[model samples]
Target chain A: MAPALFHLFALLTVASAVGVVATKNAVTAAMSFLLCLVGVAGLFVQLDAYLLAFLLLLVYAGAVVALFLFIIMLLDTQGQKNWGFKKFPIFVSLIALGLLLTGLGTFVTRGQLDAPNPNAAGGVGAALKPYAYQLFTTYLLPVQVMGFLLLIAMLGVIVLSKKIDGVEDVK
Target chain B: MIDFWSNLHPVVQGLIKGLAVIMVIFPLAGACSLAERKVSAWMQGRPGPNRAIVPWIAWIPFVGTFLQRLGVFHLMADGAKFLFKEEPVPGHVNKVYFALAPAIAMMPALTTITVVPFGAYFNAAGDAIPLVLANVDVGLLAVFAVSSLGVYSLILAGWASNSKYPFLGSVRASAQLISYELSMTLSVIPVFLWINAPGAPGTMSLAKVVEFQSLPGFWGGTWFVFLMPLSAFIFLVSLFAETNRQPFDMPESEADLVGGFHTEYGAFKWSLFFVAEYSHMLVGSGVFTLLFFGGWNPLPWISLADLVGWLHHATHAAWTIHPLFVGVLSLGIFLGKVLTLIFIFMWVRWTVPRFRYDQVMKLGWQKLLPLAIANLILYALAIAFIQKSAS
Candidate 1:
């Protein structure tokens, strides 16, 4: 049953992922993106990484998709003509796609490709205790680095936005 | 009740429990609509919806008039009207998402109930066991994640309306919900930090928070609201915004937005949105009760076990320890607190004027979010100091 469930989640992930790329309407594509995230979260749960699943759902499906839809709704007004395939963009997209496939191939060969048995105990991410313990101990330096990076990015944005205030003529 | 409940197969038991909670919540959500009307009317010095009555019950005279005046029968009338009314599809709207939004609204409202431990049962040894549908380790987080999906329904309804007001309302809703969610999540961190002290096995189960409240000492038995009052205040404010209750109900604030996201919606679809809103309110109040108020504990510094023991001593009753009786008593206390919180929700709705849109945004971002962050940092420092000193 567990293996069957895992296969079902994988199917959902792959199918919705295709839907995300194929859908024409920007809002529809955003909704498909949400479904893809949900399917990925389901796969995480089947792998017994409940915390990772919750984070994926909460962060991606919850806030990120909402922001995507918000922008799509604002920018892509109804009855607007869809952007046609331009020459330079098409050439760039092809290069990007080639790079993506190459990265996928390398990762697939080196990553944890075999699924753990259904009854096997999950690794660190299974329960809150070990995941949090490892986070504060072994992974503390990387976490701090990520935090500082995000802080710097946030400060940069704040500076860029506020810099416009004093230079504007309207006020 | 315990034996019959335990005898069922696990899957069957889960199905039955889910159905039971849904059944209770659906009508309760409906009744909340009527209660809102009555509450607003009472505050404004008027009788509200006191005319509807069943024909056969009219023969009972005083009792009939009493129920009529209480507007009890209007609940049935309103339900029938919504079911029978025409569901109109606007000519210019997106048909699929317009229809899907209400159903989507309901999914999270009902799903969050599975993780919330509402009441407790005591064994012969006086150990209080929480009665919930699924007490997963990732309890409160699951509730937050699922309920966050509710914003999708509002956004869809607004965008699908394909017109001026609804699109605007959806825009406001997307911003309001995302902003307030930051404060709500941050505010609750203090409670969890206090509960998940050093050396304790880590868990995020809501029942464990309540169990901590019920311990036998002064500090242990005290509710978190008294200890972390600032966190509780921030959480309550964010809860109002998250549920889209009045003052912060910028999504469907009828005054300017003209019915907000549901402007293009009516009849059964409209009623579904209201029900979903009420259901969210119910679940939010239940979470607040478990987090800040004592879950099934009747009073401050008085745990459920203490109450049961006092009753046993006072009456010398052998039946006080009966699981059925204890369960009912605890359930009553829990539900009573939840209902009181719901009433407070309505009371504030009637008394407080709605905040201006800019004011709402400023409060969420500038005031509440910073307050929540500061509250978290303060609690972290205090808790760490205490833990280190103890060792």
Candidate 2:
């Protein structure tokens, strides 16, 4: 029952993600994105990664979706302007789909779908413990770099959003 | 019997636990409301809610007195009032989302409690019984994740209302929550780092974390509060803003928002919003207790086992009891800490003044964020220095 339910949820989640990318209307796309996020969270729960599931829902669905909604509201774009697909978009999509399928086939053929090693020292919870260890120890440099990146992003956002004085640079 | 129950599917067990939490929280929320009123009344030198009686049961004499004494009547009366009250829908609102918002706000708060460790494990018919809904290893993160979802209720409620006040309130809430969430997450990372610091093969499970802190000796037994006081301070302050409590509750300021996000909602729907708020408060306080305070540690310096040992020695008998009894006692201790924290929340709520919207934003973004970052850096350096000295 759980496995069947999980499969159903995963299908819905993937479908909704595709819908989010394909949708023309920004608000609808945002809503679809939210559904995708929620579905993914459900998948996480099914995998017994309850913390990850909650984090997904909380961070992505809660804060990220809220941000998207705020941007949509602020922009207030209406009347559903027809954003026709670029020429060969279907061709590009098909290529991407083929690549995904090829990857999946390779993994299945390689027999990588076998049950996980039960004797592995850490279960799912233990698997995640290394994230913190890596963050502070081995990957401390990268962690600090990421912090710098976030700071830069923050500054860029403020500058872009703030009103400028009498200077409009034309292309 | 315990073994049979333990064999049930985890999801089913989770659902049962979730239902029990909801049942417990509803009355706790109501009691919180009553407590708030009584506390406020006393502070202002006035009587509060002493006259409201259970009309059906008040005439029964002895039974009525028992009902009144237990505050059972008040609970029923509150429920009745909510049921009978008019659910006013305003002219210019998205009715569906407006209606759904409160439930969205509440569901996550209620669900988050499922992972919270209430007690240590007990031997139940030769099986280990955990005194929590789900004994998932990532319990703390699960709690964090669910608590974070709580902002959506305010955001959706404000947007759905379609009124300028609610819209502003929601906007403020969204921005405030996002800003504070970063700091809150970052601050807690240090604690998680410390918990998993022994380079242990397993993750820092909540149960294990509690056990680690409950070690003998003064320094060993000291709560995270002593080692990481700044983190605890930042987390608590962020928690206040996260839950939209006083000083940070700019979203629901009566003077400005009229009624904030739930301006258009009434009766049961409005009650749901209140339920969500108080439930979040309860869960937030519980998290605070678990993370910073020694969870279920009777005294700051003493362990539960030590206390139980003392009890056994004092009685001068071979003490034997069901594991269920021990689990219940541990749960009681956890609850006692949570209640104390809740009292402090109410006390602070009444004592403090609400910050202006801009001030709230400034505090979160400019003040708390920097402070949290500094604390993290400081902790990292301190840990490094300590390791160096020890080595």
Candidate 3:
């Protein structure tokens, strides 16, 4: 049952990932990306990482994708129906292909994919304790760094977006 | 017997629960709409829908006049009207998304209820059984995650309608829902922090939160509202905004946006949005009750489980009756609390005028956000200090 569900999610992820490039409309492509995210979240759920699944939904599906859709609609960027293969940049495509192949080769040869620890503290209540403790103790420095990174990114966006009273070239 | 019941296929149990929830929520939504109208009318010093009576039904015995006066039959009439009303597909509208929008709106509202613990009951063997559909550990988070997707419905509806008013409404909805959602999520953190067992990972389960509140404390039961009134206030305000009720109904402010996202909708499709709105209100109220109010506990000091045990001993009747009685009582208590909260929502809607869009934005992003963050920090320090002193 579990394996079948995993396969279903995996299939959905692949299909929607394909849909991301296959769709002509920007909004449709964004929606496809959202679906792909949900499929990935489903795979996480199958791996018993429910927290990751919800966070994926909350952040990507709920917030980021919604914002993407909002922007797409706001700009009204429709009618880009040109889907010719000639338009595709060969250089970027080759780099992406090379990276994918390298990742797959590593997985097939040297990757030791760790199965989720079945004996690890089970249930949502038990899982959060170690998750938090580890974050605050083991990964505390990295977490703080990430927090600062996010704050910096936010400040950068605000500075870029917000217009100064005397600034004429902002727009 | 307990094992026998527990061993039933989870799919079957889920199906049963889903069916039961639909049966309850649909009528509850209908009744709430009726209540909203009547309550608003009484507050405005006018009679509400007291005249919408079926001629045949109004000719019956004593019950007929009572039901007619209460305008109970208006619910059926409204349902029928929605069913039979003319539904048009505009030429420029996106057909597929327009059709899908209402279903999308309704789905999250229904799905969120699965994690809500209505009550708890003891079986024939006296083991406590929680009365919830799903008891997932991340229950509260699941509710938020799923319900956040409800924004898609309004956005899609507005875009699909291909109308100016709807597009504006949907845009407002997207911004408003997202903004308030931050404060809503932050506000609930303090409640969970308090309810979480000292060394445990912490629970998001509604039932567990209720159990934490029911434990004997300074007030006989320590409701989170007593400990974290700021969180409760933030949560309540955010709930109103999240559900798009007045004075936060800027998304569909009738004066500005004809009908908001549902500008082009009529009949069944339009009614679906209302049903979704009411269900959101219902679920929000239930969550508020469970988190702050003593869920399923009849009174402040009274624990339903102990009272049931006493009642069983006093009656000296069959064992099954005690649990059955307790289950009913608890369900009633839970529903009663939910109803009162819903009434408060209605009362506030009528009392408060709608906020301008800028005012709404400022309140969500500037006011509530900082308040919630400060509350979280305050509670965290308080908890840390108390724990240190105890150690």
Please report the candidate that would top DockQ against the real structure.
1
Sort by lDDT, best first: what order?
Answer: 1, 3, 2
Q: Which pairs of residues collide in candidate 2?
A: none
lDDT of 2 by residue, A1-171 (tens): 888889889898989999997877675677678878888888877876765677687678878888988877666665657767776997898999999999999998997776877555235432576555556887799999999999999999898877788978534
Q: Which digits, one per residue and each the tens of the lDDT, describe model 2 over residues B242-264?
A: 88888788778888889887777
> Candidate 1 or 3, higher lDDT?
1
If the candidates were sorted by their TM-score against the true structure, best first, what order would they fall in? 1, 3, 2
- Model 3 per-residue lDDT tens digits across residues B132-151: 88788888888888889898
**lDDT for residue B361 in candidate 1, whole number 0-100:** 95
- Whole-model Cα lDDT of every candidate shown, in order: 0.91, 0.78, 0.86
Q: Model 1: runs farther than 4 Å from truth?
A: A80-126, A163-171, B1-9
Over A45-81, each residue of candidate 3 has an lDDT whose tens digit, in order, gives: 8767777788889888888888888998899977565
**What are the per-residue Cα lDDT tens digits for candidate 1 across B297-320?**
999999998898889899998888
Question: Which candidate do you rate higher for TM-score, 1 or 2?
Answer: 1
Per-prediction DockQ, in order?
A: 0.66, 0.53, 0.62
